[model samples]
Each structure stands twice: as C-alpha cells, then as structure tokens.
Target: MIIEPRIQNPASLLPDAVKAINLLYKAAHSAGVPDSTLELVHLRASQINGCSACVDAGARGARKAGETEERLYAVAVWRETPYFTEAERAALALAEAATRLADRADAVSDDVWAEAARHFDEKELAAIVLWVATTNFFNRINAATRQPAPQTWG
Candidate 1:
C-alpha cells in the first residue's frame, strides 16, 4: 500500500513559515539543552502523536548526532530502559506530560514539572518545552495531511 502526502509541505504555502520556524528552531537550539536530548524529546512527542514523518526524521537526526542505536530503539519504551540519564528522563517526563495535555486534568502535573526543573535550568526547560510544542505542531499537521515519511531525509 502507498500513502501519498496531501501536500509536499504545508509550510511552503506560507512564504515565511519555513524561515520563521527555522529561526525558532535556532533559538531552541541556543538554549543549552543537549541536541540529542532535544531530538529525543522531539521523537517522543512525534511517537505519541503517530507522526511517522517526524518520527523517521527524528530518529535519523538523533542517529546522525551520534545517538546510540540501543537508546533510539528504546525511546518508545523509555521508562522500562536504563539507557537514558536522569536529565534525559526528566526531560522525557516533561515532554510526555506536555504532549498528552488532554489525557489528564492537570496536563503537566507538579511532580513532572518539579522533576524536569530538578535537572534543567529555566532556559533549558523553556527550550525543551518549546521543542515539544514545536514537534507537536508539526506532528498535528503531518498527521492531518497523512504526510508520507521520506525514504531519505536531510
């Protein structure tokens, strides 16, 4: 079976969307969170949202940045694995909490926020949150358009 994308890229419709997103991405990257960790956060949110496009790109991004295969394979089942560091775990928790906002009344509970705060400073946490939000934004769009995952991506 084949699933074609509804469009090549939604951002292309808005002339400035890609540039604006790229600039936002640069700001997120500047905030002090490890690149791998941000990739992990992005992957996790995309996974939850069932955005195969982002998932494929995120895994590739993580791997290209030297993320271990063992860790990448375990991202979907991270809680059961010991591959992640405490900081990564905290970031993941925050990502999950933030992503699944409708699953619970509190959305991001205090415990989850506290755990993330324990590991990241204000700037880093802000970046992680931004990354998660950014990932979700893309995920929702891709899922809506049924965007096909790329065979080879940059």
Candidate 2:
C-alpha cells in the first residue's frame, strides 16, 4: 500500500485538481446527463477505485434520488442483477472501461464505444467521458487524502 505521509504543506497538485474538476463539472452539466445516471456512474467508478468516501457519498446521492437499497448494493454486481436497463448497462460499461484503464490495453474498444453510442449522442457521450474522468480524479484524491465522506451528497 502506498502510504502518503501527511505533509505540512498542501501538494502543489491541488490547484490542478480543482481546475480539472471545474472543467468536468461544466461539461457534465452541459451534457445533460440525467441526475440518476450521473450518480450511478459515480458510484460505479468509486466502487472500481475502492474509494470508500466516494462510495458513501454516491450511495447517499442515489438514495436521496429514490434508488432502492437492493439496487444500490447490487450495483457492484450489476451484470448479475436485473435492476438495470439497457441504457444503464451501457453507462456502466463506460464507467468500467474508464476506471480499469490498464486492463483495456487496447483502450476503449469498438464494442464498448458502440454500446455507449447506442445509448448516448455526441453531447451525452462527452458527458459520459467527463463523468468517468472526473470521478476517477475525485476517487484518487479522496483515497490518497483519506478524506471522510459527508453525511449527504444529495
């Protein structure tokens, strides 16, 4: 495990993180992804990254948006569950591909892209990509910083 010791000074990387987050937030809002799907993608990415804070926040967001506990728990094993729609499946695939970047040595494959394309237009696709990227950034920061989650991310 990489144990980053607490430093007296904030890392020089903080500003860059904020910039990327701001850009992604703008893109996500402009892309018009439904709030539910956004929360789902965030949760899925957090799960993949093993970021507990993100998981907690995303789960609360899902619950506040009326998602069932069963479905929330099942998200980690989504393929084995029947709670998701085709669109949701596609988005999940995108999230997985984005999070496990090393595994997809060939990069985003035609099949995955096609699946996402079927469910999302260009603008929506942009949103989906931004969502995956942004969530990954947040996961890394929160995991590395050992930040605790707030009671609500709604």
Highest lDDT against the true fold, candidate: 1
List model 1 lDDT by residue over 15-109, tens digit each.
78999899779989999999999999999999999999899999999998789999999999999999999999999999999999999999999
In model 1, which residue pairs have backbone atoms overlapping below 3 Å? Answer: none
**Count of residue pairs whose backbone atoms collide, per candidate:** 0, 0
- Candidate 2 lDDT (Cα, whole model)? 0.82
lDDT of each: 0.93, 0.82
Model 1 regions lying over 4 Å from their true place = 152-154
**Tens-digit per-residue lDDT, 4-121, candidate 2:** 4344212344667566667777779677777778889999999999887789989988898788899899999999999998988899988998889899586678898999899889
lDDT of 1 at 31: 95
